[model samples]
Target: MGQLRDRLMRRWTTARWTRRLGAGAAIALMVLSIQPGLGNVTHAKGATVNLVMWQQWGGGHEKKTLDKYIGLFNKSHPGIHVSEVAVTDNTKIVSAISGGKPPDLMDLGTTGTLGQWAHDGLLQPLDTYIHSSHINMGAFVPAGWHAVQYNGHYYGVPFMNFNVGLVYNKKLFRAAHITHPPRTLQELDTDAARLTVIKHGRIVRLGFVPDYPASNLEVFAWLFGGDWFKNNGRTSTAALSANIRALQWEQSFYQKYGRSSVKRFVAGFGQYLTAADGFESGKVAMMLDGEWNIAFVKENVKRFQIGAAPFPAPAGMTSRNGTSYIDTNPQVIPTGSPHAAQAFEFIKWETTNPALAAEYATLVVNLPQLKHVPQTSLFKDPNFRVFENEANGPNAHQLPQTAISSQFATNLGNAEEAAILGKSSARSALQNLQKMTQQEIASTH
Candidate 1:
């Protein structure tokens, strides 16, 4: 949700948990002492349900938006009052949950650990709540909804979702005499060669860099009709032929442009979200990036006309033209929350209420998880429309939901990096990844 991931995934070590648990205990005691009535009251009619919510991303537009929502939520639902704390350290959340004093509402910030936390009994299942509340399950974007599920149950609700596509500078394309975004991998290579500018054997501008901005193995693999898991999420499929094909495709870039030369060219790129960002500054003609980049480019770049389209499909995979990788910022209630019912009410209201959901989505500039969002004029901008369309497209997918997902993402990302840098052959890297992920899954239990 930010320029870079907020925190690195931490190992689930006992010593680490012990330290966090101690701090959680201290924090719980202090909170109880200072505010004797922080928990939810009786479920009687008109009784106020006070909720303490700890969120992951805060202190800017995110904070402002959440505060606005809380204000609106509290005003409309007179019986529920929400107090939010900006929480950065995920270990503190685990500590609080482990110590049995978790917040009534938790914004889990990332989708990668949803399955892991749910399997560990750190989250409360919402199937019963959804059924009882008559929540319309089909209203959510399919991929975003899938991200909240694990082992046949939904553990959370999607807060906001994102899907990545090919973002290109129209000015650069015009300069290269390219009329449209490439629709196939072969065309992409031809366009990239035309758009790339080399001076003195050094790259002054790059046409595209697959792994730049973020590790995008998942995106490419999906485009190539590959996935990391199968057998209903019980096994690793990193070594699939399609995955190897994706890796070799990424390697072609490094192979075409010398690895060291490309490395040196990229090393000069500015920090993401800044004026000198590779794409924003027009130093890179194209990249695989999310919908947020549209707003970012509008704010930081003045001379370029930025456009978004589904990443080019592998040759002859015309059906995969709209394929994209989707992920979410999910919200969940901890297993031990005393205000589970009240929390569910707030969650459902915030996520499904069309008025509130639209306002929040507009303010945050994120793709609303709800299906109705695309029809609304709130996201009438062409760039937003492209992403909204892609989010609802049939080919959209999310990574597998599994207890070892964090490790899986890390390993596959490393495998992608290795193959791209020529540190390992694509087949060999994928084989290693397959073995490592299988071991992770085995160790998870």
Candidate 2:
């Protein structure tokens, strides 16, 4: 994309987007073999390919950006029509694919769902088309394609990307008498204690509590070197001791102040976009969260001194350069689609054609998966480059790419909850996770 950066300053795309070729449109752009205007377009001759897309990353605005790509694709290739159905929620992709019906294309949110799909034989490999088109995989940022492969075949074509980090409040830290944000677990604990405020036996404030449900727990698990899977990611083993340590750290606050009290406070917490967020209302001193919240914080929470840093680690442990990242959304083409060939043609044009990628990305904030696309003002922020850097950082680990990854996540969650509730020890949880995950993998086959 470095060359794209050069072309970008002029605000022009390196690829052409046009319905009719006047002189130089690439032969890569193909209309439906079934020519249109002969009969009702209800049938599929030369008609535009119908595409159903699932948008998993970014906020609502991200969906709008993808839709704009559809608009551009439609305008440029009037012969090939594309229809998009909006679906977010990165977690449910397996169900969507395994439910025996899947969209023509979907964004797999760096969730490792693409790998799983490829392994399950649910996704078609595009190597044939890619090689023929001379598409350079090198143009995309590494993470965009790293997790897209499983057992040597690639199922997904990369789209947008993201990375998670720590976001906190400067005003809240100052009020808690914390001069510096925590860099280690000890400091994190000390800051949490200072930030905790209780009145009438009711908790008024708490520190940045690790919201385990949100994938931040994975970062902590990585810290302890205890992964959620076993056997090179063919099975789940979420009950690892590292996982237990992480959960213990996560639940430590509730244990310190009392879960009941914390629950009561949370029950009354207000809207997330408004003042209800702990960082927004001065209710929390720190947080381990994602980058999108940056826009939300800047947009919704005003008059508060906010800042972000890498998550603090335990003593002698340095928070790594990147994180337990799930970035790079996956765009897949469903099998048995009537417009398979046409759909593929549109995919090649939309993803490989720098013009549509640049135009669509202009409105979307996520990093474009297409190689050579530039980071532009279209993202609405200059600091977003930080997220892109983080995605390329070493701390990132591809989530287990297997058909049962979704189920493994579920089992891993149970192990996490068991430890959180004092129902089991971390060691036993890990062992049980291993056993159950192995069973699930065998059963799925």
Candidate 3:
């Protein structure tokens, strides 16, 4: 899952390039589609159209799997030749598109910037091609379909997706006298407290690290019935009451252990995907992670049994019990590509083909973007089944699709960090974020 890891790494740099793009270059490109000589490029009759494609997965099984598929695509579609290159740095993508020379196709890892990219005319809409190709939009998971759309237009295709859940060490739970994973938020807190182990006035084994390894405050916000945006992703609602409650809940974990103590503990944690990783090393008992973690544990961890369950919702929120944050690896054709038609041809074949979609998802351990893909042996993995159910659940959702989505996520992360580290109250952090993001959105228009 190198591509998945690459997507995760985007969190560190999103606020930089994405922020600048959202504020500056993106604004300049907002009217690019209306410019003459910028229309979609089509191929001549029976002529081969060559396309350059870029993606984040640099090497390993993930890249090889994609290469295999691209090979298959090239072989099948003789009229279109799609060549892929591993380009992990997003700034290069921005530069290429802004300079009017962009790859025909690209997989941007996540939908975090889909809205901004589409709104700024960096990506060409696929609605016409989709309609002409008879692509069944209903074949996708609802959240996956939603993630690829901005302003009622389809700008990208979600090929691989996953939703997060609670993963716990069964051995640790049994030792703590817990028979089952928590099914409600209250039980989660109690179990975390019970499973935590302290020694020499330091945390040696933590019950849970709310922000460890990834950003999950958004998941908590979903569970608490809050969202960062509403009214079809046009307005900022960063300080929604439910969102504030979720932040408070996340901050409580840091408050339970002193901020300095928690910070030091997290600082000492090993790099993710390594043997010394906190969860893999048994230094952390519980975590909120995507379905890919199931395969990671199966391949990497041998010391204990790992269990996965739906992330708990607040008490009495039965309707929200199975909620998970739906995330995707979305592919798009940049505007002004010389081979937009051929690029769509290849993307359609890669994403909509049942056999290929199933194979790709299995190779990467991702949920197939299509809903009715034929099940393979991968479905038999119990932990994966838990996430599969969560992905199909009604409450599963992606982040709001807005032109400022990338910046919104960056601001939200900052707010969560401030609140969790005790630099400011949750309400104050969120309220301030609300005003700033609202202003950013307004300026974009």
Candidate 4:
């Protein structure tokens, strides 16, 4: 009886061992089958960090180009995966950060907001990252570097730079018997007067419109040796003599061509991106715009010969000759971003890598922030060369880095419109702007 019981126990143990072996073989086969899929997973096991990059560039071409470069970055750095989100409104970014769910990286349209955000303690100073990454700050253009700096600290990396140029129609100039583009503001006015045409008691075409496409108050203010701030951007200088002169000069155009007529003409104009653009449609001969117009003209208006020149300076202001106003779309890491280090890694790559920088600039038709990238063949093309040269020139100036810069710009625009429409004198408009700007500056403090 004892021998029979031991034989039964042995049989049970053998059955259990056979089942275990069969289960182990099945597990091994399953693991082998899934081995080929491991590499396909972007965030597998070893030291992978995912980041989110938020930007306001939601236009079709802009988003497409940005995504292309982002894909390239992801393919090159397997350890880091960056997801891009197009948050077109700045208020959304503020709300997200306030909600503690901010993106790791952001492409704020212009560095004008850097001061306000930095002052509000919403931005992380990138000095450490800039130094640790061995980034040569000198490699960036002065205007770009200036735009990103606030209170003696760098808060962002400037990715693209753009300056306003005098985009003109060559055919229009020839028809007006003008052989050369204006080199001074006085000459520009003369050209405008000469090139304007009137028929049947109605203004038919304007030679140049200073505020067409958009109102660039800062550019005109700078051209007149003025700015919105003084004393290292602590005080409002909106009512300075130079700014008043700039406003008066702008008002002169509307004064010469009846304000109602100019307004009616502008109202009748089409959107800037479409083929019906006033400048492209030969309704306007010249306009003060950025380099992106080169791409727009190429794609939308192909029937004319387009030319670009430096925005002429005030006569006798030789120092302002070749002057251009520069603005940049800088990449910043929010204060509480969990992936700040990884975000900097990508910023470093995008700014320092020549090929990537050039490709981005070319794709967007904007000037590259990196000094070396402008010398590439893409920027040297005839349509783009004028802007490239003006960007590299000594007279390129960035907007004043004030916490209330956007507000200041808005106030100036309002004042400009009022003065140009003959509703207020330049002095009164600017004085009002000064009061408003000062109040805003004080409130921020």
Candidate 5:
């Protein structure tokens, strides 16, 4: 009976040992699974990584086109799932980042904003990624490459490029007995004066209005051999003589056509997107606009006859004929993105793959930043050719990359408006703008 009891006791001890071993093993596994960067424990092959992207192109066909490409990317990359969210207001993005929940990828609509963000240390420097992917920085147009850079570090990738050009009405030019588009600033001014039509002391049609549609001080300033900054964006040049001259030139339009009359005439125009656009309806003969205008004209005005030309330069400065305000929307990764490497992979694929790049640009009717993509048949249409040519031109430039770039632009706009409205002389307005921009720069530092 004692021998039988010993056997039963031994069996009980063995059972208890087995249970303890099993529990210990289970605990180990639980700890391992929670540990980070352990292969198979934290992330396994074929495991899905979800990423979110925020973009400004959320309306109309832009949204549809972006979604189509995103869907294609997801299908092509089974392990990576990218969900797109449309966020047009940049302030929202700022708030998200400050809250430590920024999207994995963001498409800020201008390089200026990208520069400001990068300057604030809110972006990831892409040098390592660029080197790992063997991206040829020279493949991008010089202006585009310049746009995405700040303090010698690249924080964004160029997506679509657009430049200002002189879009004119061919029918109107022919009616005015002008055989060719103006080649110089003087010619443009003379053409505009001749094209101006006054009916019974009321201006019926205007040939050109400098501040119509939108006022871009950079456009006019660049055309007149002036820039907002000097010494590689280290100093404000708002009060320089060249910029003053540019503002005066803009004010001349209001001076020539009484401001009150011009204001009343401008009020008569309909919204820009509709068929009654001043340029489309023969109310304005010439204007400085971007490549996207082609798509707008094609969609809205069926019978419109238009001609695209390099924006004219000052007469003696003929070299600036093709000089334009080249702008780009850069794709960026926020600083705290968990899937930065994956986001960059996507950006490299989208920007470097000629076929995909061309497809995206074509759908949006924007110029592809890739040198070869612009040569594709999709961009060979005459309406887009002029912009493509200008993209390669020598004088294409982006706004200066400064921390206060947006504020600087706003101040310049205010100065231009003040000058145009005859409230202040061009010199005084620019001087005040320079003082304000300087103060902003100092405060930011």
Candidate 6:
């Protein structure tokens, strides 16, 4: 799915729905240059595996960590050399595969890209080598593995996982003289009101931004006894209507405080976590963000008393408790890499090693992906355990890992922006979006 992902990146990042899903069989193809010299290393001296891995974070620390992995790979397997390069965008991976110089392995955070690449013939299947080595994939969560499969064929190996939580400002709550965090839905609303502040006819402090990132709608819907798509627990389109819940939630906030006031208050805010970041500046009381923010906020904000809790439903609402969401960072071996054997070895050693996982997780503030990484006293922060347990729990689902995931997320985000802005009625907005989504999915098949 080289070009497919390129188009997806364009759509997903811009929140545009794709217009075409064309499949023409028996297209012109360039055969792989079968370099027996490259694949055959039995008698070769120090055969090197050149690798390029892409991830969202691209600072020097992440670079050093990857360098460490290559260092270890080279140290143990002197005969099998490894070279590492880091990427900021997965689009580069697209270029490499289509250009026929694809990296030996890719770490795309889950099965979606792996499945797409494999379906597009960019990825080579790993089942043969996996069975031969008897690799125990049980250590990784089910969602990543499920994402890696396409019609029973596994194309990638998973690396890590993470979950979301309701992070709040504790100092502000205490300043408001509220002693305890909300337990029930009603109590949360009451606490929110007390925590919020208005200045000069503008909301300087917002209780919560229910529609932030739009992905929260899915988690909230799941928590509030709403299903975006559920057929006997097999499928989901939950994000679409989370916009409805968001609209209702936002509309309620608007009713309590006029829409004009809410708009002006929101408009004055800066980006999510930067200097103008509402949470970082204490302008927003509560938000739904992922596990990495635990370390990030601790490092960035010095004076704020930060705490986290599972989001709650309104008073007397009967829905599942602690029903949260997971945003995983999974790794996969691409389908058409020239160095498949070396790639598998690298992933097997890295993923299976508890020590390295703990180290990386520390830097990123996510739970160790390994089954054996212990939660020691040093790592025993309250919300840290919450994220870890949720990641490995029954509710942990690697977000919809479909080949069409980019489209779904974009459409859902669009629906969310529209709903929050009151550009269209909530029901009509979703109905149009779902109809469009169905059309897009059908075009693909």
- Highest lDDT scorer: 3
Q: Local distance difference test, per candidate?
A: 0.80, 0.62, 0.81, 0.79, 0.79, 0.62
TM-score of each: 0.84, 0.77, 0.85, 0.83, 0.83, 0.79
* Winner on lDDT (2 vs 3): 3
For model 3, residues 15-128, the per-residue Cα lDDT tens digits are 646654554654584554322122113234356766778887532667889889999888888877777778766666775676455778898888888898888888899889
- Superposition-based RMSD of candidate 1 using all C-alpha atoms, in angstroms: 7.5
Q: Candidate 4: misplaced stretches above 4 Å?
A: 1-48, 198-204
Please write out the lDDT profile of model 5 over residues 1-445, one tens digit for every residue: 4533543464357665575456457557453232111111112235776778888773366778888888988999888877787777665676455434467788887776776788777788888898889998788777777888888888888888778789998989999999999999999999999889999999999999998778867778888888887777777888888889988998898999988898889889998746687888889999988777776676678988878899899989998886777878788998656568888988887778777778877777788877776345657677677888887887777776778777776787799989999999999999999899888887887
Each candidate: how many clashes?
A: 0, 13, 0, 0, 0, 8
lDDT of 1 by residue, 1-445 (tens): 1201211112245665686566556667454322222223323334676788878753266678888888988999888888888775666666567655578888887788888888888899998998999989888877777889999999998878878888899999999999999999899999999999999887999999878888888878888998878886779899999989988999999999988888888889998866697888888898988777765666566766888888889789988986787888888998768678889998898888776667777766678878775345647778777777787787788777898876787788889888888899999999999999888888876
What local lDDT does model 3 show for residue 400? 69
lDDT comparing candidate 6 with the true structure: 0.62
List, residue by residue over 310-348, the lDDT tens digit for candidate 6: 666556663444567664455566544555777788777
- Pairs in steric clash, model 1: none
Off by over 4 Å in 2: 1-46, 88-102, 110-112, 115-121, 177-180, 212-215, 235-240, 267-285, 299-306, 319-322, 353-364, 370-386
- Candidate 2 lDDT (Cα, whole model)? 0.62
In what order do the candidates fall by lDDT, top score first? 3, 1, 4, 5, 6, 2
Sliding window of 10 residues with minimal summed lDDT for model 3: 33-42
Q: Between 3 and 4, whose lDDT is larger?
A: 3
After best superposition, candidate 5 residue 96: deviation in angstroms? 1.9
